[model samples]
Target: MNIAELKEDLISYSKTIGIDKIGFTTASTFDGLRNRLVKQQELNYQSGFEEPDIEKRVNPSLLLDRPQSIISIALAYPTKMSKRVTSKKGERRGIFCRASWGEDYHYVLKDRLNKLEAYLQEKVPDVQLKSMVDTGELSDRAVAERAGIGWSGKNCSIITPEFGSYVYLGETITNIPFETDEPMEDRCGSCNKCIDACPTGALVQGGQLDAKRCIAFLTQTKGFLAEEFRVELGNRIYGCDTCQTVCPENKGKDFHFHKEMEPEPEVVKPLLKPILHLSNREFKDKFGSLSGSWRGKKPIQRNAIIALAHFKDETAIEDLTILLTSDPRPVIRGTAAWSLGKIGGDGAKTALQHAIDMEQDEEVRVEITKGLQLIEE
Candidate 1:
């Protein structure tokens, strides 16, 4: 079999199917990422969402038998919403980060990879192959970087020159020994913009991230957000984009390449107050299709309450009061108590007084006291 001809044919076929960028690399062990992940584990910096087995994550051979090559694909997502959401007075909205804007990227990228897999199977009969997206054991960014899809940016995203960092990544492992592509050069030299712009200083320094301090990671946690970081959560409901937005490389880099990646203005930036009352069914119906809903509605609703406080939206007081006074979940009740303090007013104080009187959870009571203290301050 002519390997060069096969690779050329594969690359040609990829663009026909809407793959924004594609690259190939040998399935050698990822030496650098193994060390970094181990160090991250040692430092207690991992987000806990990562696959626990380090060996399976770093070595493609562990994932696929006799893995000879890996293919990395990137699909560009839009940065700018074509239809702008009208901002009205009093009703505040919470923003989802760019990555979670559209139909869950997992399905979109998987659809693309499935097509590529079928094409490869037809080309090389009995070809051994495996594919994975973000939820899989492999680090999408690491695979993309080593496969020449893009460079590892300071924000920890693969920044392709053609598509910037606003791209969803996926990979396929195969036994075919295709020619590998050269990795891109790191372009963030002396560009301290992303590091300086992290809301919680989560990007500790350069390319390293303290995931516990990251707003994106924080937004996904089911527990009560820490007071210090809750103040830093700003208006982000699902994820944080401060680092990516501040990066110079991403300037003028919006690409609406795929319809699946297009953001619905109202859906991605929904009103903060309305989210506070969504039933499980309602939340699933509205946001289930997006990537942000992976952790379910609790984290999103909790973040939305914090976002309402960021806006100091008095309009949400009634909704926040309901959650604090009667919500079944302690995390919801506690977070509502905190938002009440941040959005202090006569109504907020009344709600806090009511919560303090009837709250049963010890943690919820403490949050209620903190809320009252904020109002007094």
Candidate 2:
């Protein structure tokens, strides 16, 4: 079988099945990425959500027997919402990052990978293949870089020239020998837009990231946000896109190529007050389909309270009071107490004062004390 011909046919089939970009590379060890991961670990900068084994993450040969080549695919998601939610006066909203705006990209990418896998299987009767999406052992960014799909940008994202960084990446490691594409040159040059725009200065320098300080990483944690980074979160509930949004390569690079990748205006940017009151089932029914909802509703709710505080939303004072006084989760109650103090309404101050006396949890009590302090100042 001619490997070159098979590669050509696969590329053609990829377009018919909605894969925006595809590339191939030898299944070699990722030396640079391995070193970077070690350094990131030493600095305690990793998000802790990554595959823990550095060997599995950087060495494709370890994942599949006789791994000869890896095929990387990129599906571009829309950066701009085609539809807009009509927000009323005094109505505040919290935003999920663009990556989570659409259907859970994991499913979308996996479906495409399945199709590619099937195609390869039919062509090579005994094809040994392993496909992976975001949660896979291998770093999708590193695979995409080696596969020539895009260059690793300063913000630590794969920046494709055609789609910018708003692309979902997936990969298939195969035993079949295939021709590889040359990797793209780094176009970022000396431009520091993404690094300069990071809200928490998470982009420490160029390609390095301090995930501990990254708002994108912080918003996903299912616990009380440290007071230091709470203000940096702004209206973000799920992930941060500041670095990508500010990139010169991403300028006006919105693409609605795939229908499944389209953002529903209300879902991506939901009303802050409604989010604070969502029952677990209601939250699941509304947000279960989106990737941002994976961490469940607690984190989103906590962030919503902070976003309300960011706006000093007098209207949400009632809801914040309810959360502060009776919410089961200490994080929610504590955050509500903090938000009430930040908003500073007459009733909000009253609620905080009452919470100080009734709250049993020491952490919640501390938040209540802080809220009272804000009211005093």
Candidate 3:
């Protein structure tokens, strides 16, 4: 088959594989992405990598050595899959966002892309191919914009007319040259709901984010968190999806199939009490297959304790008390003290006192004091 026929077949196969949109462009079409990377670097908004070079990311030769064509794809994740606002018993209160509500997109896309590559190899006989779903040096949003899959919104996400910014992206770089799609027109226009809805002032004037201040980055980051940012973590233990929630275009759409990648009966709305007691093995058992599990259980478990604090659940005093004295991780003990203080009952105060007496780490002792004050209030 000719390159044009192969391109059409590729798009058809992508749709069959459950991808909502697919578009093709030259690997070199990411010049605008390169510029944005520079701007992000200058402003210090690099998220995944430290000291990222935008110029290299957009340059195909740097990414693929001699790529001729780039295939960009978008998978729709619906807002309807998210839980309703009312906090209730048995209902896991808080947010996992819409995109992460189902199976991990990386595995889903890679399995399908590999099949497509095999099909092309049978027909074309001598094509070189490599695929990436947010894992390669290739710029995903950049190629999606150039390929006409969607326009980039002010929030720095690709916005499709039907799916908005609630989509996952993947790419394929191949030696075969195919006809490229025209770039999509920017449609964000004058909307600012995404900026207005952000609980933290992470969004900038043009919808760019400072990763250092972003809650999405904060909740998943390893190590010590700034005291001021702790309260703003709210109830999110893994990721924050506020920007996408407020997008006018994303309102009332169904995108996910509700397939939890690892099927942890507890993770659908995991209980904060149990999380505080997790051993390293239990942590891996619960979150290993999920995207954020690589950081181990400490960061997420600490966030869970903070979320319990946010809920101010008096019922958690027993669990928090046990964690303060018995939990091996100082971070968990410290966060439990904080949560106990947030709950603010006689029992919570007693737990905080015990944690303080048992605490050896200075930072933990300081957090214990802060928790005691919250109880006093």
Candidate 4:
């Protein structure tokens, strides 16, 4: 079998199947990424959502028997919504990040990977291949970078020359000795845009992130968000895109190549007040297809309360009061208490004062106190 010919054929096949970009690299261990990950761990900057085993994350050999090469693919997603949701007076909406704008990228990328895998299987019946999207052990960014799909940008995203950083990445490890592509040169010379644009200062430095401080990570947390991050979250209910949105490389780079990757403006940016009252099934039915909904509704609801506070939506005061006084979840009740304080008014202050007396949870009580303090000042 001519490996080079097969590689070219695979590239052609990829274009037909909606893969925006494709590249290959040797299945060597990602030594540089491993070192950086270790440093991140030592500094306690790890998000805790990643695969715990660093070996499995950087070493493709561990994942597949005698892995020879890795094929990386990138699919560009639209940065701007083609259609706009008509804005009404006093109506506040919360936004999911661009990455979560379309159908959950995990499913979309996996579908493409599965197709690539089938193509390889047809060519070489005994090919051993292991495919993974974001949730997999392998770091998609690192794989994409080494595979020449894109260069690792300062914001820690794979910035393809054609698609900027607005691309979804996936990879497949196989025992085929495919020809590899050359890695791209870093073009982010002295550009501090993404680092400076991070609302929570999550970008500790170029190519390094303190996940704990990242609004993207914070938005996904299922617990009470620390008071410091509440203000930083603004209207971002799911993931934060400030870093990507500010990148110069991403300028004028919106692509709607895949129909599945297009954003439904109304769904991605929904009314914050309505999100506060969604039943679990209703939440799933509306947002289940989007990747932002993976953490379930609690975090989104909590962020929505904070967003309402950010907007000082007098209209949502009633809704916030309901959550503060009667919500079963302590985090939701507590977050609502803080937001009420931030959105100070006679009614909000009254609700906070009443909740302080009836609230049993110490944390919720503390939030209520904070709310009252904001109103007082």
Global lDDT of each model?
Answer: 0.92, 0.92, 0.74, 0.92
Stretches of candidate 2 off by over 4 Å are 86-88
**Candidate 3, 236-303: lDDT as tens digits:** 87778888877888777665532533233355456666776777888777666666565678888788
Model 2 residue 376 CA deviation (Å) reads 1.9
Give model 4's TM-score versus the native structure.
0.99
lDDT, candidate 3, at 287: 60
Candidate closer to the true structure by lDDT (higher is better), 3 or 4: 4
The model with the greater TM-score, 3 or 4, is 4
Q: Distance (Å) between predicted and true CA of 93, model 4?
A: 0.6
Error of 1 at 66 (Å): 0.9
RMSD of 2: 0.9
How far does residue 69 in candidate 1 sit from its true spot (Å)?
0.5
Q: Where is model 3 more than 4 Å wrong at Cα?
A: 48-53, 81-94, 256-266
In terms of TM-score, how similar is model 3 to the real structure? 0.91
Give the C-alpha miss distance for residue 203 in model 4, angstroms. 0.6
Candidate 3 minimal-lDDT segment of 10 residues: 257-266
The alpha-carbon deviation from the true structure for residue 35 of candidate 1, after best TM-score superposition, in angstroms, is 1.0
- For model 4, residues 224-260, the per-residue Cα lDDT tens digits are 8888899888888999888888899988998989999
Model 2 lDDT on a 0 to 1 scale: 0.92
